[model samples]
Target: MPKPAPGLPTREQILDFIATSSTPAGKREIAKAFGLTAQQKIILKAMLKDMADEGLIDSAPGRAFHKMGGVPKVTVLRIVDADDGGNVWAVPENWHAETPAPRLRVRERKRGALGVGDRILARTEEAGNGWIAHPMKALARGEELILGVLRQEGSKLWLQGVEKKERREFQVSDAGEGKPGDLVLAEKAGRPPRITARVTEVLGDPFAPRSFSLIAIHKLGIPTVFSPETIEGAEKIAKTPLGEGFGENGREDLRHVPIVAIDPADARDHDDAVWATSDDDPKNDGGWKAIVAIADVSFYVRPGSDLDREARRRGNSVYFPDRVVPMLPEILSADVCSLKQGADRAALVCHMQIGKSGELKSWRFTRAVVRIAANIAYEDAQAAIDGQIDHPLTDTALKPLWACWRALYKAREKRSPLDLDLPERRVVLDEKGRIMSVAPRERLDAHKLIEDYMIAANVAAAKALEAKKAPVMYRVHEEPSREKLVALKDYLKTFGVEFALGQVVRPATFNHILDKVGEVDFRQQVMEQVLRTQTQAYYAPANHGHFGLALGSYAHFTSPIRRYADLIVHRALVSAYKLGPGGLTEGEAAGMERIGEGISALERRAMEAERDTIDRYVAAFLAERVGQVVETRITGVTNFGFFATVEGIGGDGLMPVRDIGGEYFRFDEAARKLVGEHSGTEYASGQRLPLRLAEANPVSGALRFEMVDGKGAAPERDVKPARVIKRRGRPANIRHQGRKR
Candidate 1:
């Protein structure tokens, strides 16, 4: 057919031409291709000028043109990995790693002071083969990198810092490319004034198999693989037994005592052992003598040594479902320092006397040489105690140990600590390192026995040091703040339970609430709330008395092979008691404050890593079963959505308000619920509901759920609607509408 009337091209048509063109097309080329007349060409020129002004197209001198708005004016980026010629590459702050992020060539001057884990906001522009960026603001600059997921909201990107205690999200540069669910390594550029980040590298998707542990390990900057020097030092220490040079001298020989080690079945390190017997003294009638000997790690890993430094840096061993990242190398943690059965090992022993009432009468600390009479798991020990299983040492050793545990438990009961019986979920992995199942780890009497003994031993160590005026790092759990107590009282009022809030609330105060909740339907929910209100336990140079344990003074003095704090306590005991050569040095004593803070940070880091790994594995396990209806109890309710833990699997998922029917909901913080506007339906914490798994994104470690039961509000007389009145016309749950903005 003949050509129709020549007319000016629409914006869409012009854009399509430019996009489909083999190369960046100019005005003359566009006019000729579209068969525009001379008058139409004039109009086309004006349109091209307008498009250029609108950032729709880039017009260069001499008619060169290209697509515009490809590069952001400002974005956050990090120099992830160093390339050849000292050049480094960067990804966008909100990268999901769905694909490769845009490569950036930062100027040499801009790259100065920038290192891995350093985050920076920069101005970016397209250069010859890649984008060039000038870092305008340095957000955070540190040696440690943060591993987290990148999330995009409109044109802005945020890093959901996976650090356990960090609740605030940090802004990231948008220049580099990342999806919502990508695991990324980020860095802080300068300092506190600028709180932003740049994605240095994308680790992987959070939901991928085995990726969960990796993300946690990387995010927390946990040293999974030991350094060559640490490994070599550990290997050297392992080759020479501690008894050869470091043992026997000034050491009490406790090998004659029938001290047996109790631990988990899978535990490789036997750090502490217990021995108990009736005191035959008529003056001390109805009394028992108990001895707790912990592995002497300081005997091998001395001060300022490679192993010691690494252990100090790690703070404590991180236990993951797939594997363990030991504070010390395997040679020390699993062999030399491990108190194995019938093997002579050096130890820090506490000889304690307990009267008939389980009250500690007297205690003293000393260095010792001991041989573990037996090594038993918690399950086997419990079985023997229950008369279901028989062991060679059942009558002679196990029975006395059980009796000692019973007496100590009586003391524990008398103390009336905040006994919130929250069962911790344990992830069981198969041979291939995939999650087989998730279940609550049974808390047996044997477990409690070990715990009680450890507590007693720790207390003795603190007492010994305090008596000597030695500098000690106390495991302090401060009392709940006034604000937290007020919130707790308000929450308890919703359940028709009232707490006397004015007086000094002690662990005993929480125990009353916990005991009252045991028979309630929402026991777990109430326990969780109580736990949330309690302060986190951490090491401090000054004693602040542990509130949760109801202890006037406490310090971690068990499992020196796993915990650096315990190692320090061992050194302090040696120093205070003048036991031997491996004692706390003056330099270490002076720097105890810094060390305490550092180890406390590491402990929080490990907790975050462990929790994140579990979340990832749970997400992976449920990925294949999308759309299956599952039962869950709402654990948390916000304005946007409610979070629930899946009943059997124990995986937490978000049920967005938008998916909870058409009713607009309002968040009632006091009630911990979302109240529907028109429908009057409420989704509150502790409410059991059926949900269908709509999506499981392993990369993001996020699960989305849809409401299965279309149940409305509770019965009229039975329920008390929150005071928040619903409004008409607009939606009430606007905050929960969408995160992408």
Candidate 2:
């Protein structure tokens, strides 16, 4: 064999040097460290290239070298999983190795617990067998990837956002295999002034049926596919015997109680059943006894298990117009855990005693075996009560439920919860996923009856946990902040409505303000303002009164099949009552705060995804009606434009100031209006107007409108250049400010 070059390092030596380097080691650094001669340097470069080809070392930015299977000493990582012992695991942020990315145990240092999808900057070291990462700092979360259609504008490709409020078109840098008008998922490649994106996946046609929900599923990072382990766990748990000993083993038998579930007509799963009857005790005349049985999801999804982890990661089931992204596998969420009629199901039942005045006198929790007598749709239940349909279970089950709900309604009236009668739009889709129609869902008394019972049961669970001094995840909705209240007051003054800021605020206060508005349009406008004034409700370990429900304590204990918060509550109840196994564990109890925060964030994400999908669906439904005049109500106003929603169908469309025609409009911030200088015409929220739909983009869920009578013409006189305005505080164009009258 020929003699080796004097400074050439062996393969093992090169790998060790790259792995242990304090700083990024490129070819020059490696050559310097080995003291290579000038001629040896050329040989070293060839050796490094051969090593890279052999998959021994990889090159990063700045031509830095790293061990192919190892992470850089200092690098960015994305958290992927958490173990049973509460340890988090992460992988390289930009992994491109042929092998699966190595999981590195993250050792947090005086920082909050990290969750899946969180990004961090870490310093890594090779431990005895595995890699360990010490987090240097947490990175701001990257924006979710965009799911949109690729469009070609004069040979320049642009990616259109699939959200109603996303107005900017991202410049496409690399289109990959995506063609113009194809649905594609793209990631941000460059930052602003000239924002750009690179298409990652070409998802066929953008106008295909069912594409609307797919856009949301990918854009929001919602998990639609379950892991194999979780599915196997669910299947195994689903086969567990529910009636071996006939409720003799740590379970009460309530199969003969004639419980009934009332839900929507197209409900996919029934998670709650209600049973009520008159209180037979003479001392509690006119009172009622009730049981609210919720699906025993905690029993099937135990802590530290695969099912539990996946459920926690989902936070809650996301319901779209066409389908549902369930938190649990179908075996559990749809079949085993659902309260199906005539099938014996294990449940966590809440037994409550009510007084004549509908006050909850006493409550207890127990594990039980239940058999739902019927699963009736809300419309059918209301119909039976009105004598429109003759049903066998109605007189026996539905009547008693209504009787019980009447008493609860009395209590609800006294508490006077915030009753904003906002109409929720429902998107009905055909089997092919094409839009059939969009309309406001009917509000019925039967719906209110079921809601009240659930609320009562949720309150009982919270108070029961408090009595046992156990952990509780309260559904907290705090009073509005002073800033929001002040804004609401300023807006209300525009309507000549007096709102006293000094008075202590309650749900009833808003309800009273809404009651005084006789006009429906004005009432809706005020309702919107009231909603903007309220704080978002969320789950927390600490107690904060539920302002919307007018309850001193509240917790979700129903629908465990859909919501993780309710599952946690179920575990708490089981541990508090000593009902059986599947109780809250010590580790879970200790991390309640972190769990609350993570799930709350997931809930917000789900809401946004659902809303975006609905907007897309609405836009698609109205695409055929372009150039037609429609009745609209102004919903919001800004300096640049005013937003309005269709009268019968709800889809927001913007009327830009430039399209309003022949005038320069001044934005009135406090009053939330726009006044045209030349025409002396005024536009404000709650004003009914006729607008011609000019353009509708289904890919972006955006709609553009113009005044039905006004021509699209420039203002008669030249005016000062327009500038961006902040959403808060006083308006820059207020009278007598920087103006000559």
Candidate 3:
């Protein structure tokens, strides 16, 4: 039904216009609706043409014709002071994060905006210009725009989080106001279909640890549904045991075994203990059986309890430098559920027989009612092995312990060469959170005793789960990237050693290289490099095998008090033994499956936080020794300078190219070298250099070092310089490796 407009009403008399009507209107009639002058009509046509190029509008053939419906069809009369104004968003419609949920990326347009290896700088979405996931585009299964800053490095996002509640109010337009924390669904008023949303949850103060954690949690969308109340509630429901906590009912008593705890000296929340004794002679093919009794935490922390809910939420405990943010309360983690010394706590035991060759013969998993006979520290255990400490570890206990460790020692040679000696540093902190020192953490035989038994238990559990067809989470590590190996190979060549740069680099080959340098003073630095070239692995139901351990199956079945993974493993094992370890419908185990994802994310968070804390301490320690000359190994090389870390120091410091006295240096990413543009003087990864600590800052906890005596220096590169081509790389020549004699 057409309202008699043109036939009855003159163009000048028309009050308002209706879009897409049954009756067609000419340009003049539509222009009349806007009360547009002849000159203004020409301007509108020009504006339409410009908008069309951006996919915002469908343009007519010539300036003489008027078209509609190509753009979003927003109508506004030119009553306000309108000029050549556009929308506020800077990102193009096609920009996207090329990685997973936590990865955020952006195109940089200015210097110092970001560079490779720099921390991602977090920013807000100015009014309607924020970057978040575009759900519609996601529904369309294409691209998404995230709020992130791009860096000059690998395909990874430096996740910097912004909290909504902390946002201040903004005047998006002179006529409009929006609060900082308010969630806004913004669309482009200027260009093609542009829309973004802002959430109202303020992340917290930027410098706060909570802020860092917030960026990670919200960015990854790790479920934090369980609250403090839930934690309190879990405590209430955990009074009764979940599995073997059913007491001496359906399990064997192994409390009399010479079970001993071997953990970090300061560790309070113990998890698993070890014992290797002669197996039931009638059943064993040969040799002894290793018994691993992990704390029966699943027995006490029942499913659906408040504690369980909160534990499920945190997924795991985060360890900081000075303290640990536990998954459970101190009452639970440090006492009741903890595998405390000499305490008669219930446990879930895995019994496996070891053959003459140290290979597993047969294994059985059960909820055993037992207690830890010894709560000894690793140092004490180490002393006992060395026959040094005469007090804590008695001669009577030493014999059995020594025998077990000796047996495991032989097993290493018998088994595949899986023991990869990685350098680990212990960060020291002062009273004011400043770095005191960085000391190498000692790895001992006692530590291995515990490790060997745990590894055996992991194998047993994996096999049991597979045998029963149980749906359980396995900690699987994946293979390294081929591209990373090429980069590493190029970097290694600066030091002058021949290595495989083709195909993929094997862990065993890398391990062999590290072993060859074991007598070298710079071995730790090389080991540190190896750590960077590796990838972190995590939990999945399907078996991918652990790359580092060279194991076909692996799982974390210890430290339930601290790690949620351990608890999940315990729960699975308990259910399996009772009902048989097997796959169940995902529908029936939705809660637990969700728990797996959340905990896996938290585990990463905890690891990152721990590393961050150590970095802080290392920085603090370096600050104290500023202006002091220290010998350092070039653990890494970049366009900026060589990254050198001294032995006995845990923190990393930078040596700017300017500090090198002789030649102009440039970063060659392809070659992983710092080459002199003029002199051709070079330095590569793993080279020993004498660096004088120049400057250190406490707030950022970063240290800077300068070369003391090396010649062949080139003029310093500009603050922000262009990239350069790299030469072929080789293994480094050891200038300071200890002689075999």
Candidate 4:
């Protein structure tokens, strides 16, 4: 509640009123606006006077005591209406704390705020006195705080404390005597500038804050972020192919594999396609067979051409909250080489065999021009498999494909393969790129068919490298790091499930754990956490074999369209076995190795940039659902808040530490939790709990979650458990957030 027309109301009430206002208003205006009366006015004036003493606010030039225009928006939102009415008006992210913590917080708006070149952290306060703030830590000792001060007001400085307050007359920090109003520059002095000051250096009024964030990102040179120049250069190199004249040099032809690609309904670039079935081919005893055809990107993207030069520079495509900074331009990623429906395109095909007993019978790799019979969405093909979607592809030719998918699933189960599949959440957007809704993306049987075949092809690549003794960069997924495993074991122990943390944890152990806990209510959360413990598998010359797929050897081979490594690997295989680039010069191999490393580094950065973009979209999606409570599973625990996997959405967000008001919580780094020092209030990782959706900022991609008792609430149950969704390059699609909330 806003202090009623301020008849000298309490500081608490005044603060609350300030927090609630969405727009800046005069003190008297606020009083009149909110209906503050007689004594309340007196009390409010005194409170504002005290805050003025603290340099938190300054009265407007030539303005009377009751008039407004002094409050620093940042501090106003800090303590005002922070409780009770909910911190609605925010600075664009969770919390207004001034700590060095990585979380975004509210900083102050300057004189020329909202103008070009004038950077200010935005803060919002509704008329109800609710406020939310995000802080910016840009000022440092000796650094310049450049700002164009717009207005000058008759404001006096007073020093104030809880019991007593006094006025103070001081000289202006700016060179000239601080006049009624003057834009001035404030350099950080002996120590870092105070976090509370709104105006640092007043540059001038006519300036802009437009695209300030992008500028900062570029200036800071954060390794993960990329510039437009970097993106532009890489795109050009992707257009020209390297080894062009060698197409007819004796590579095996599998142009008639009847291959099809099944990706998310929203996927644009198709990289890998599969045609799988029972092949009684006389190569060995009759067995199930797979022909995994990948878009032959290297065939067109040369090593040092303009296209290759840009590709080399970008390393890979970068994704941001609302957009994609593609490594290759749309000309390549989605067109020319895109394996779209009914397109006869060139590819590097991996022919593989799986025995009846769920074993890799045999495999072969070849490069050729292949035709895609169809391009189907994962769900559509899954519908075809489940008999829910009776489409032409299923009736005309996919029935046998369905059989192959079933066989692959069986092979996966019998092999005790590591099921690293996690739910995927898609953030749907409207025309202007605003997130309209968040929905879960399913992984159907048809998805498994493609996944299994890709795995086979990957293994084939790894095997070929091993056979020729080539120092190729393999996509090695080593065992979970010991530290991660220990933390995981501790987390599970809190749940009373003693996982065997012996000398080693094999893939089968995870599979076993999944089987044992699959029927439990909180199993979804547990499974994803277990999945998270596994380090992100990466490419290296040293083969650490992927544990998740239960494969002896593996490398990404079927997505050259989106991944540079796939292109390199495709070139290596073709040269080694087909076109004869057999032996590398010492210098050549070293150069390729160096190139691999560069590409790997860029790949990581691009992935981060992509995640950053997705995060922003998801944040926007969640912000629209304030006050909605959903059953959720705690996927991670942090000091700030616990992150949850909501039921239907494949996304994650934080349940902020401050919003969880019931008890003072501490995160147990060993086990990942926030527990009350007293009252035994505990929020454990992987615990299914009810989270009241509080705030989500799309711009910063931050989520604020609140935890409440979920005792009687039904545990979040998944309709179809977590599964990995592949989109043929960059980072894999990670869906989450449907843990019921």
Task: Evaluate residue 417 in candidate 4 and report its C-alpha lDDT on the 0 to 100 scale.
Answer: 70
Question: Residue-wise lDDT of candidate 1 within 52-95, one digit each (tens)?
Answer: 64557754323446556343446677666454466655656633
Error of 3 at 303 (Å): 2.9
Each prediction's RMSD over C-alphas, in Å, is 20.5, 16.5, 17.8, 22.3
What residue pairs are clashing in model 2?
Answer: none
* Candidate 4 TM-score over all chains jointly: 0.62
Instruction: Give candidate 3 regions above 4 Å deviation.
Output: 1-228, 241-251, 280-285, 391-398, 417-419, 429-436, 488-496, 499-506, 515-526, 579-597, 666-671, 678-680, 707-741
- State each model's CA lDDT, in order: 0.77, 0.85, 0.55, 0.56
Across residues 436-464, which tens digit of lDDT does each residue of candidate 2 receive? 99999999999999999999999999999
Better of 3 and 4 by lDDT: 4
Best by TM-score: 2
Better lDDT candidate (1, 4): 1
> Where does candidate 2 stray beyond 4 Å?
1-144, 153-156, 163-173, 190-196, 243-249, 713-721, 724-741
Cα lDDT, model 2, residue 644: 93
Locate the minimum summed-lDDT window of 10 residues in model 2: 732-741
Task: Indicate whether candidate 1 or candidate 4 has the larger TM-score.
Answer: 1
Off by over 4 Å in 4: 1-244, 247-257, 281-283, 319-322, 580-588, 591-593, 627-681, 687-694, 705-741
lDDT for 131 (candidate 2): 97
Model 4, position 377: C-alpha lDDT score: 83
